[model samples]
Target chain A: MTHTVLVTGVSRHIGARVAGVLAADPDIDRVIGVDTVPPSSLTRGGGGVALGRMEFVRVDLRSPDIAQVIAAADIDTVVHMSLVSAPSKSAGRTYMKEHNVIGTMQLLAACQRSATVRKVVVRSTTAVYGSSSHDPAVFTEDAEPIEVANSGYAKDATEVEAYVRGFARRRPDVSVSALRFANFMGPGVDSPLTRYFAQPVLPTVLGFDPRLQFVHEDDGVEVLRRFAVEDHPGIFNVAGDGVMLLSQCVRRSGRPTVPVPSTAFRVIGDLARGVGRVDFSPEQIALMSYGRAVDSARLVEELDWRPKLTTAAAFDDFLQSRGLFGGMPLTVIDWLATVWGGGMKR
Target chain B: MKHTDTSHDFGEQEPGTAQVIPITAARRRSAGGAGKADVEDRLADLLAFLRRRVAGEYEVDEFGFDPELNDKVLLELIRPLYRHWFRVETLGLENVPDEAGALVVANHSGTVPVDALMLQVALHDDHPAHRPLRLLGADLVYQLPVLGHLSRKSGHTLACPEDADRLMRKGELVGVFPEGFKGVGKPFAERYKLQRFGRGGFVASAIRAQVPIIPCSIVGAEEIYPKIGNLRSIARLFGLPYVPITPLFPWLGPLGLLPLPSKWMIQFGEPVRTDEFDPEEADDPMLVFNLTDQVRELVQQQLNRLRLQRGHAFPPFF
Candidate 1:
């Protein structure tokens, strides 16, 4: 039997990729893509390229009509990824709480109403663990949830997981899985990771060199696809098999990391907020202070899934694809120049 | 045999009918020692005298109250351990009251209860008055066989209010860790952040007994066994206090039992006079909680100052 999957925020980076993957699957008869905005220039379509067996629907997740849309589509599996990832502190507050928290509530309610809906996979984040000092070893699923102080993003993600877990408990037949993702980069990561390379000077919070793990965009989509088809519940840290230092990422990007004290970074973020110079906030500054390295052992052992690319290799591929690096080594002069002088102003 | 004085200088004296032993004479007597066995016996007798001075129930079978046996066993067990693992230093010996009753409250840390034992040894060996301190051990410590036997022999009792009050009333020096398990068992990230202390049990006991409460802070106990993480599931399965992954434990496995040689500085703060307050004051829950918070804040300030002064994670090796 063909499955009708309902995917939210299908116009965004990860959501679009997930929609593409599900549409390509022969067993999936239709994928309903829901987004707040109409297909923008960034949407996944060019010229005559057809979206195989998918349909796009514009529906504000915060609207009362969300349940009606899900029901009309006859969604058998709901992959809820409608969340505001804009680093702009003010922009995400209402959006995240509504779409990520209340929206999931409505989606779960819609799924409950539809007798055919059997599974739900929500894209969660490692931010639930918060930006605190973690054990050098891999943080397993069993590790206690670290307390997040001020970041709205981290707090919202934690609330989302609680809601999903609670929903599963009430509806025993529904298989709900929350994928706590680390930093992911691939073909379309032109989203967040590219900001590091484009900015003149990549600021590094001194005294804290955190281990970062990145999952390829492809792998992220594959994991979601598997979760949609399989019967599994609870939380899992979804990322590539390995981890890297943020310093290495800077080096790989051919950009220099300007070492700044934590206090200075917070000051800069605050000043930016006051002057309306940038979208960064104090909470974003706090998030940047620590790196999260989560364990993906359960995803592999239980779900029988693995990343198709390592972080280093994926990053190199991204750099090559963007034409950022062309057979040249990063030099001491490049480092000193970038460190002393801030990157070209916007 | 000659007597040598190890008593510290307190400066000036109140001339009265109170018998004052001359500092020079005490030193001379302490210096005048005979054979090693005779000196050991004298030390043992001194401990017994101190124990008797402090009024409390003594159970040699259950609590192991033989001073001679304890001194011998402690000397054997701790001396080598300290020599191999710690460069131990004690300060403010003069602050310790030579008179009968006093309460010593110290900030607690280290993976195991090693600092408590070390403090007991410091009081017995180095204090000018040569007081035998009664430490209040956690309930878990008393449940272990070898640990319980050793602790009892060393004059340690369960951390119970009744036990603490009894020991203090008898004019014995009582040591209490207000921070309890939270302070010691804290993970590596939150180290040095003192946990919430229970309402002033030490203060109540001191006030009841008209004793002075001394605030003690120990730096370097945190480094001895740094708790990196904990395996909560395993700890629950085995009914252990905490499944600690210290620098030595999980990394070194069995060999991790040997602690790294960290230099320790244990300082005794000025005593708080609880005698002025009425014993009825202990009954006021708000007063007791406020007093405990005051003591905790004072200790925290001292710890912050010490951290600034030291500046290094590990002590400098000479």
Candidate 2:
């Protein structure tokens, strides 16, 4: 059966890539890419192909116009990828929460009313697990967050996932897939985590080095496209296997780090954000303090697919794109070792 | 007459003894050459290790077990304490499986949980296969900042059933102390008396993973910091189970934190097979209780017998 898919948040990197990939697929007849603003070359980060075949719809999910856009083409699949993690210059926390929470509610409401929509794929976040000391080493999809994210993008994603669950309950016939993606890291992706890593000196929480996982941008888009085109319903964790400690990530990027006490971490984040160095929200700060890793076994078992890169490999790709090496060159280290060894032997 | 007879015997043997000196010198010369090469090889190995650590080029398992770091650094740091300070004597290491996964249920003691570290050192250094013991620590261990990170780097994880089951499924030797803070903080008079085993979570995990349970009894940990009294108010303020009032502690201050030099002995008891029971039986409270009691009893019995054999707290000879 041919699919007429409606993809939200086409203005962003992952959303645009997913729309482009889905539009190129022969199995999908028409891909409707909708966002409040038109997709520009600047936001695409230079690698995505032109999204020529997809139709662009200027519809803010918070408004009632999204329902009309969904109903116009007899769209059978709705892929909601519009959730914003960090506040842009024009938008603040209030608007971001509005776009993420109310926008998702409106989109689901529209999908619920539309008789033709048979599949809904929502791009959620592993932040819903809420990094904390009480968390399991690796979270399965079914594990509830030990400390619920009280604020920020994690809270927004948690609310978005709940709305998706409600939508699934209401529309029993429609297949719903909520992809709880780990932090997206790769070339051509501009995420809060990527911005944090781009800094010259990383300030980390003292005494804490949380385990981190990443899903490469290409894998992220591919997973989104597959879920949009397939019938694998229910929630699934999408992440590259393996985990890297945050300190290890910083060291691998060849950047110096300043250890800040936990109480002072927020102030440091605020100071960094004030200079436009990186977008460090409270949830992101907590994530750096107590890192989160999700088990992607369900993705492999049910979907018969795994990410192409491991967590470390994906981080290395991100580092390569930014022209950062892990540390001092190996040759220099070998030379130093030889000199030191000779001196010690004497 | 006797002196002359002894002189004649020595005189007859002197030339033959002198003939062996050249062969001994040749052997020594080759050994000296190898020793020089060995130093260079060790230096290269140390340099590689430092490079890996600095470049973050090592791998940790899903549960954050860095085998390379654990073997090279963490265990090495504890080896001196295990060998000299505690003078650890390992027994029945043959009871631990050679290859397959096994759960080692040991009694918790030593106010600082140094016993756990010593037990790990013993298994790694003494076992024929030199297996690494993956310890399951309490949440408190992971709640501390530096300690938590180091613990994970050294192949330890939260003392939860999920971690236990996962470690065992991976054919790891998982160590657990079901008594938890109770056994660790008990008074000096109650040293050898086994505290109540926790809600049988370890046994359930062992059954679910179908791994044998090896009862390990570690003596001499209790004497390390003998708790003569408990400062409950101070413990509450610090969020600790107990503020131990040892004879030296709080009286001598920083210097008193040193653990007493007690002779240590770790005895691994017979394996309690869990494969006989179905995995579904893990949910049966009665079976779990019975198995937990059985393991606890085995550990306690061995503790008594080992304590008897250990004799004095600090022995002059083995």
Candidate 3:
């Protein structure tokens, strides 16, 4: 078991939660949360997630200085959670890529030079299995990854996993796990897919109702924490069991679906991207049109881990936590969640 | 200005438009009670289904097999084609065990996969137990977008060893078309000739599952959409195996997609027990090939017998 842990990307919700959880654990002696920018409201040691007994360090993973921080902490466990789910408006394309791919490369290189690091857990997404006409119904762990298109988060993650594999090959003594999580949905973390669903009139491909899968942000953090503490090595898919159709999800979320023809969808996507309203990247469009599924038998059968919420429940959770990050106050959203959820139950 | 009394301009030819209230006891009772119970009952059933769907109560297998949808909705649509249009007569339903894992290896035909759907209907409707058949579909069935989810909801999975072994181990009836596209898309002149079964995969799956291989031979499907010619280039453009040039297709457009109302006969031969050999023998190519040949011969012989029994392509009755 690792005593001191280094968690990268603490500025992100999942990363902060992970660092907080590890710091609160009595067994762990120290928790070092690192990021280029200090999180806005994560008051030094404790806040929403109770960052107990933790220390925040401002270190950019893209620089060679990240190694000095790792060496100073004498960290035995490294949890890399800085991989951005989607490119943000404020963050330019170059900044996002530099933060993800270049940052991951530099961070892995730092870990390689570190003498004490024993276990490394990476936060990867299921998008590595790109959606296409040729995709199997449900991809098992043994299947090869689909060819990702250029300039998408999936492409970056694919390259990230390749680098992780190389790291594992070099350091046979250390254990490395790449957790491929489904779409993240929860109270605080608002992913782009959730934003797309939150639209009043959801757009769908003309004749496609693909099965969509989602994992709660809480479940993602728990899986990451488990890998940080435990010795489960190798790649594993993290997702709930059941899937909901995209139309079904939109309907359940109380939104009407607008069927966009092929050419119209592309045009609308380009327009949306031009003004930075939202991204309808080709990979995301392909996924929305022909939903992808992964067989995570290895998660439970081999690693002995299971997610708490199913896909439908995760969507419900997202709805319940609506308005949390989109300029809506937490107290108001909590009260709304109570009233709305209660009425729906009746 | 020609301003006249607009209300009386028609000279009382038209009756005044007003709301008619049901003031009498009989009228109100008829409006409130008559036929309301029947409508209410149907509404309640629909509401229950919707509630089940919302509450996620319907059971789906690991492979996304929705028994509720398959039994209640999808199979009902196929019943008409099975009963009246095709007038399908099925034999040796007794050979299929009432409850057990069994592999029904059938010949693929009909240019399209109408035969597979009909076979599924036969196993469900004609059998004493009314068991659903878990059809192992080809890549084409799942390669298309909406068709993939529909196929899964209709209780079919991709024809792979993982899914096959899982279904059989769960004691479900599995149906496989070993001839695949080769048997289904062949030219009409070569109709009813059993194509070469691919590499004996079904036999291997059966052997691994330790289930009996029930040879199901389907007749009259070839005549439904007689493939006079094939356009490979056009088919490749649309990502299909081949553009089957049926007599009515391409010339008739969308209206021609429908299959002909040909007479049909389905016969299930005796079970070739995989238990006769060791389960590990699934790994042996020779043993798998022998069983594959045996199943093919069984289905081909039955196909010939059924064709002779009907004596015509479009028999008046089965």
C-alpha root-mean-square deviation, each candidate: 25.5, 11.8, 12.7
Kindly report the root-mean-square deviation of model 3 from the true structure over all alpha carbons. Answer: 12.7
For candidate 3, what is the DockQ-based docking class?
A: incorrect
lDDT for each residue of candidate 3 in B1-318, tens digit (9 for 90 to 100): 235566566555455334444223334355576675445445445555655554444545545667777877888888898899989999999999999999998889999889988998898888989888999888777767668777877888888776788789889999999999999999999988999999888789889889999998899898889899989899889988899888999799997788888989999999999988888999999888888998999989988988887667775553
lDDT (C-alpha, whole model) for all candidates: 0.69, 0.87, 0.81
Model 1: per-residue Cα lDDT over B103-164, one tens digit each:
88888888776888788777877788877788887766654435643565577767766567
Which model, 2 or 3, shows the larger lDDT? 2
**Which has the better DockQ: candidate 1, or candidate 3?**
3
lDDT of 1: 0.69
What is the DockQ for all candidates, taken in turn? 0.01, 0.31, 0.10
**Per-residue lDDT for B1-318 in model 2, tens only?**
999999999999999888775433554455686775556556677788877877889887777778888888889888988999998999999999889999999999977789889988888889998898889888887788888888888788888776787789889999999999999988899999999999999999999999999999999999999999889999899898788899899899998898999999999999999999999999999999998999999999999999999999977753
Model 2 agreement with the true structure over A20-82: per-residue lDDT tens digits? 888889888899999988888535545455675889988888998998988889999999999
| Segments of candidate 2 deviating more than 4 angstroms | A42-49, A328-332, A338-346, B1-32
Quality class of the docking in candidate 1, CAPRI style: incorrect
Comparing 2 with 3 on DockQ, the higher-scoring candidate is 2
Models ranked on TM-score: 2, 3, 1
List the candidates ranked by DockQ, beginning with the highest: 2, 3, 1
Q: Give the worst 10-residue stretch by lDDT in candidate 3 chain B.
A: B17-26
User: Which whole-number lDDT from 0 to 100 does residue B171 have in model 2?
Assistant: 97
Q: Highest lDDT, which number?
A: 2
